[model samples]
Target: MKAIVSVKRVVDYNVRIQVKPDGSGVVTDGVKMSMNPFDEIAMEEAVRLKEKGKITEIIAVTIGGAKNEETLRTALAFGATKAIHIKDEGEVQPLTAARALAAVFKKEGASLLIAGKQAIDDDANQTGQMVAALLDIAQATFAGKVDVDGNKATVVREVDAGLETLEVDLPAVITADLRLNEPRYLKLPDIMKAKRIPIEATTLADLGVTAAAAVKTVKTVPPPSRSKGVMVKTVDDLVAALKAKGLA
Candidate 1:
């Protein structure tokens, strides 16, 4: 079986994001960029499956205009045999990405598709499900554990109520959650080898797909600043404060 892993470039989780002065979007200038944490976990899971002889090949793919090839190179260093980059110059919406991915998925003849549950930048958490819908395939989201047997997979998902297990057949989509697995660090030798790995690049037009935004961003504003915390010396003081807020 061949597996296609969706890798995304996102703002490094450790960096503090600053919204634009005009409230257009978060500032990316001079910000650190890394692969989405959840996507890393997804890639790690695919690597593990390959190591176990469950999958024959792993293809990593990323969609973006700039800095996307960097992310795909990271995936190659992590053990993906090859990578594909869907080059999009404009803003890529979830549906657009899903369509582009679906096209590649079909072209690659991938039986399994693994991706992050959500991108850290937007956190929409919709692409995996959208791809499944577009391809008319079974899907398992927020997967915590995945066990493959022949053409079927047993997926344990993390949910609000608890963990839920579902069996999905081949040509299925799975989104990796936070606790899926810790990604392995890249070695210097692996990094050198990754430089030589082939990364095929194609544009949205080249794929014969139009890139259109299903959702438009009006503006992006930071959350309201948190108020200072006050220490109460007595229970009565806490009660009085709560009463002031109409919570008592």
Candidate 2:
């Protein structure tokens, strides 16, 4: 079996984001970039599959500017055998990104594709599903556990009510949830080794997939600021305030 994991570079979660002065998008200048936290979990799961001998190879793929190579290298340090970078300097929406990935999947002939359930920066949960749709394959999203045997795989998914399990044949897609597994850090030796590994770069034209339709961002506004509440001197005061606000 071969596993393909999709990774993404986004603004570091620790950074304080600010809207661009032109209102076009968030200002990313000088902000640190890191692998999407959820994608890290997906990469860890893929590495585990390879380590356990369930898969023969693991490929980490990403689509972004040249800086995305950093995110791919991080995956290599974690245990992926190779990496693929799709160079797209312009903004890419979830649908377009998924289309590009699906094209790559077709060329690579991977048995399974894994990715984060959602990206933190955009919070768009559409990419994995879109890729699966484009490939016309089965997909299990929000996977908490995965077990592979023979040509079949079983996945446990976390749902709002509880948990659900699914059994899929080979050549399926799975999106990982937070509980899937803890991602491991790259050791010094592994980091050095990863630096020597080759990363193949490809363009959208190389895949023969047409560019996705344009998506317009008319405007963006900040979320409403929360109001401060008045301090209550006693339980009665609180109750009175709640009653006055019809929230009692």
Candidate 3:
């Protein structure tokens, strides 16, 4: 079975996010960028499936400019059989990205799609579901554990109530959750091999996809700093303090 993994290039999670000085957006210049952490987990899961002989081929696809090839290279190092780069320089919103991905998925005739539940940068948490909707196929989100058997994928997902299990037919979409699996570290040899595999590139227009309406950022601001806490020895004192602050 061929599997398509959507890898999103995002600011590294470890970096402290900085809003743009003019209140336009988050700063990305000179920032450390990496694959969406959740997408890394998704990639790991796809590799695991391939290792178990359940997946015949794994293709990693990412949308962005030339720089996004770095993210695709990492995916290749992780075990993706090939990489596809959808070239788009503009800001790619969720629905538009979903359209781009869905186009690639169909073009490749992939049987399964795996992606991060959310991108760390935007935290939109919408692309995976949107892709499923566009494809008119079954979908499972926030999957903590996934097992593929024949034409069905059994997914264990986390929910507000607790956990939910789903069995979806093949050619379905699944989004990886935090506890999905730990991504393996990249080895120097694998990284070198990944460098040689040319990433196939295409434009959104080439795939008959178009950018959606642009999102205008009114302004950007940081959260207010917290007030200093007061020490209260007794529960009564705590209550009194809360009452003083009009928070009780």
TM-score of each candidate structure, all chains considered together: 0.96, 0.94, 0.95
RMSD of 3: 1.6
All candidates in order of TM-score, best leading:
1, 3, 2
Off by over 4 Å in 1: 239-248
lDDT of the candidates, in the order given: 0.92, 0.90, 0.94
Best by lDDT: 3
Q: Give candidate 3's error at residue 33 in angstroms.
A: 0.7
lDDT of 3 at 15: 96
Candidates sorted on lDDT, descending: 3, 1, 2
Worst 10 residues of 2 by lDDT: 214-223
Instruction: Please estimate how well model 2 matches the true structure, expressed as its whole-model Cα lDDT.
Output: 0.90
Give the backbone clash total of model 1: 0
Clashing pairs in 2: none
TM-score-best of 2 and 3:
3
